[model samples]
Target: MSAMVDTPAAQPLPRRTEGSSARIGALAPLSSPGWVEAGRHLLAGLESGVLDVNDAGGVLGRPLELVVRDTAADPQRAAAAVEELAGLGVAAVAGEYHSVVARAAAAKADALGLPFLCSSAVLDALTDRPTDWVARLAPAQSHGWRIYAEFLLGAGHRRIAVAAQPSVYWESGTRILREHLAPRCGTVIELDMGALTPEDVCDALADHGATALLLLTGIPEPAVSLVRSVRADRRLAGVLVGAPAGQPEFGPWAALLGEDGAGIPFLRYLPERLGPLGARVGSALRERLGRAPSFVAFEGYDTITVLADVLSAGELSRERIPASWAGVAVEGTRGPIRFSRVPGVGVRQWAWAPVQVVDRDPAALDRFRVLRTG
Candidate 1:
């Protein structure tokens, strides 16, 4: 349980090889403050049988055994974790929560002929590379931006700008926004976070003639800055700022924004059903993280759900897996997830990405006063 443990002995999963059992691994980052809490909810689901592999006693001859590894937010460590899962005879691994880690672990999965289904990672480089041994249940970064772009167009904003730091997410934000805007918009700009002030932001806004902004940053600190700057100048007070992360805190900033941030919108993709199992996992997430985790946990939770159905169909054999996994739709928290096989990748399904308008109440200051439940 310590941070510095070596590649320990192959401690077999409890019910494995005893009869019929499939091995599934969750490659998680206990180090990430946001995602690790999500992992805990997923763990609770796995432990409680909310994600039942038995599938009403008709899917497979075996139940699933979940193995877990802490990537600790290190990419090399993530790769090593995949190798360990391969050695443990795990049939598949959930690549870590970031694209770099997913890409690293994917190489091992491809070489060893194991399936690596992505959960939370959203780097575009992930899908750009063609591989059969890897596929993701979650949307690629491009998909995320695509959803955000559609949201913008629907809201009638043509000029777009991104406020961001130069991290991996920012790099992805630049690429996705460029692709989404180039074909359809008249003006697009990206403001770097190297250092910024109200005047600098206003100057950028003026250059683009922006009526709306797409805040690439997850939090609205940059959006707040924009509001303060625009308000002081009085000319730009009504400009809109929207967030894709759907964070609630953007609510209070609306007051500073006048009308810009209050009714301002956000985006998310979610499951369509409650099934027999969802609440169990959702509650576990709340217990562990003190709040509901995001689509990331749903991705991890759904990975198990699909595998459970597949394993419940027959004995744990590679040949039997294809029939079980192919094109099967999982009614997960993120709606329906299906899989397709690429030449080098094992089996992966294209995900349906959706965008919705989240109403934030400034009176409540970003708390979920009422969830529209799209």
Candidate 2:
């Protein structure tokens, strides 16, 4: 006898409790290899400050609770995570480190009409997409590329060799650098990161007589390898090696390279020169994690703090958050945090995010001196 097939009923979406707590969703790569600690630091920042709303008198008289979800740095998983967050009835969503995952989650959040404030995803296109519900705390790669190009040119490096990994973030940054440097520099050689080994890259620099080498990659392994190779080769001694501000694994980079990482500069959002607020945040982070906070950690802390301020001033709802955010100007760990619609990047995005150049010298490695700000 043929049996009738059983159909499972769809699960109901989570309803807002309408009580003393307001829930927010955080989507990040908590299980991934490189970004797991970043996720933890983000959570720690929230719980220690904004999420402890009850002690701080709460936002709109409601304490904040963060609902954490791991995206595993996967695009599909990121999209699903957004849906799950919406189903759980969060006031809004935030936190993502990977550019691909952030892009996916941004689209999902926009379609679902949820507010998403991206923390550390620096891919230029993350804010370039046509989405009104999404905003970024980190400056786009285009802005960062401009800063890097200017820094190189100002340092009298005319012959520049670019080595970039094959990824969305690196590719976009490489393109921007080429555009900005072509007219200004005497010679700019573009090298595909995957096609060449560390030795091959150094050899190309030696062959071209490049004065400076710009290594653009998100992963620490390739950057560490390239820096090591360059230092070992005596011929390429004077070439100034630099990296962009996307690598969150800087602690590992410092540990692996030791003194070799010295004189190698990279862009960063959080300069060591902190104001009163920045100093307080840094101390709190050190206490919680047993070390100073990374740029990603600061981004997470600021994102929640911004959201809390917005929620406190106006009605607590996803629809109202964007409008509220656009009007307020708050002091972040970096500096004044504000949002505006740039010509290229999307609306309500924080375009004027500050950046600095930090070197990895053994004696002064921790000193994140400000090279340039834009």
Top TM-score: which candidate number?
Answer: 2
Q: By summed lDDT, which 10 consecutive residues of candidate 1 come out lowest?
A: 1-10
- Candidate 1 residues 1-374, lDDT tens each? 11112212222333444455566777876665324544454455444343344554523545566788887667788878888887787866764665666777876665555667676666656633455456666556666666667666766777877666667766766777678867885456777756766578777877677887656553346656655566566555556666664543322344455444555566545543444556666676556546565545556667777666555553554334545556466676545667654332233545453434464555653443322333
Q: Report the number of backbone clashes for model 1.
A: 20
Q: Score each candidate by Cα lDDT.
A: 0.59, 0.75
Candidate 2 lDDT (Cα, 0 to 1): 0.75
Candidate 2's displacement at residue 22, Å, is 0.9
Worst-scoring 10-residue span by lDDT in model 2: 1-10
The deviation in Å at residue 13 for candidate 2 is 9.1
lDDT of 2 by residue, 146-193 (tens): 887888888888888888777777777777877888898446788887
The TM-score obtained by model 1 is: 0.72
Clashing pairs in 2: none
